[model samples]
Target: MPLPVPDRLCDLPYAHLLTPHTGPLRSDERYDTVHFDGGEYTDQRAGGATFLECAFTGVALSGVKLRQARFNEVWAQAGRWVGCDLSESEWQDSAVTGGVLAGVSAHGSALRRTVFRGCKLEAVNLRAAVLRDVVFEDCLLRDVDFGDARLTDVSFPGTTLEEVRLRGARLSRADLRGAVSLGLPDGHQGLQGAVISSTQLLELAPQFAHALGITVKD
Candidate 1:
């Protein structure tokens, strides 16, 4: 049986009714665990709801408020979340591959074991958030703030961190291979416990030597 598509929030009595197990739904209704494949959610308010095992591929969620919500094992591939507020939410074991998150506010949220591969995260605010075991591979992170956030076992391979703020953030055991950064005070200040290529070190050696007032005379 094909699931009913939601058209409006008023059509459903509650958000849970839009789930696959329940009856059909309108096209504009808010839902939980609703198979929203290839759909767009614009200017919706679904705060404090839990979406378990939901798949949202090639979807757009703009101007949405998902505060204090939980998204467990959710797969959102090729999705776009612009100007969405996901503060204080928990996204556990979720995979968001090939997505775009622009101006998304996830302040004080928790992202555990979440994988964000090949995504574009521009001006995304993750201030004071807790991120554990999160991997962001081949992503473009511009003007992203991680100030005072807790980061454990985070990896960013082949990613661009241009003007990305990581001040006062704990990056112990974080891998940053092939990451390019500008506007950083020094390479050592921004790269703590991060893996770097030998070529990168050789390129940065002159800068490090200049900072230490040591002259390399050959």
Candidate 2:
């Protein structure tokens, strides 16, 4: 059986079912236990809106801005967020699956125990974010920036990362055993407790040597 996708907020009985708002979303609105399905939003601004225990299914968001939004225990599946601004958002214990997120800016965000599975995230900016116990499984991450981020117990299994920037990122006990095409930026101090395969270690040998100030002679 396949994993169930998020379609409705079953926990909330009296919640509002929002059809696509057409224009920009109201700022600082608290949408608790709201459910959205197959809706389309373009160039909308939902900054500072609070989403608690919400569910979004097959929603299409284009150029939507959710900057400083708060999502607590939210679930999103089969959603497409293109060129969206999610900077400084806070997501806690949420799950996102089968989503396509392109050019999403999440700078200075805080994500704790969030899971992103089977998602394609391109050019996502996570600079200076605080991610704890986050997991990225079976995802394609291209040009994702993690600069100055704090990652604790973050796992990336079966994930392919391309041009990922980890400069000044602080990793404590991160798991990267199943990551592919991984390369750290100039400073490597961020990968202290990261778990990598032997092949990956061999591939990064030269960079490791350079970081250690060791000259290898054949």
Judge candidate 2 at residue 28 and give its lDDT: 88
Winning model by lDDT:
2
lDDT for every model? 0.73, 0.82
Q: Per-candidate TM vs. native?
A: 0.76, 0.86
lDDT of 1 by residue, 9-120 (tens): 3333343433543332223234455666667777877787777766676888898888888887676778899999988989887778788999999999999888887899
**Residue 206 alpha-carbon offset, candidate 2, angstroms:** 1.6
Across residues 95-182, which tens digit of lDDT does each residue of candidate 2 receive? 8989999989999999987889999999999999999988888999888899899988888888998878888888888888888668
Clashing pairs in 2: none
Off by over 4 Å in 1: 1-33, 180-190, 202-218
lDDT of 2: 0.82
lDDT of 1 at 38: 69
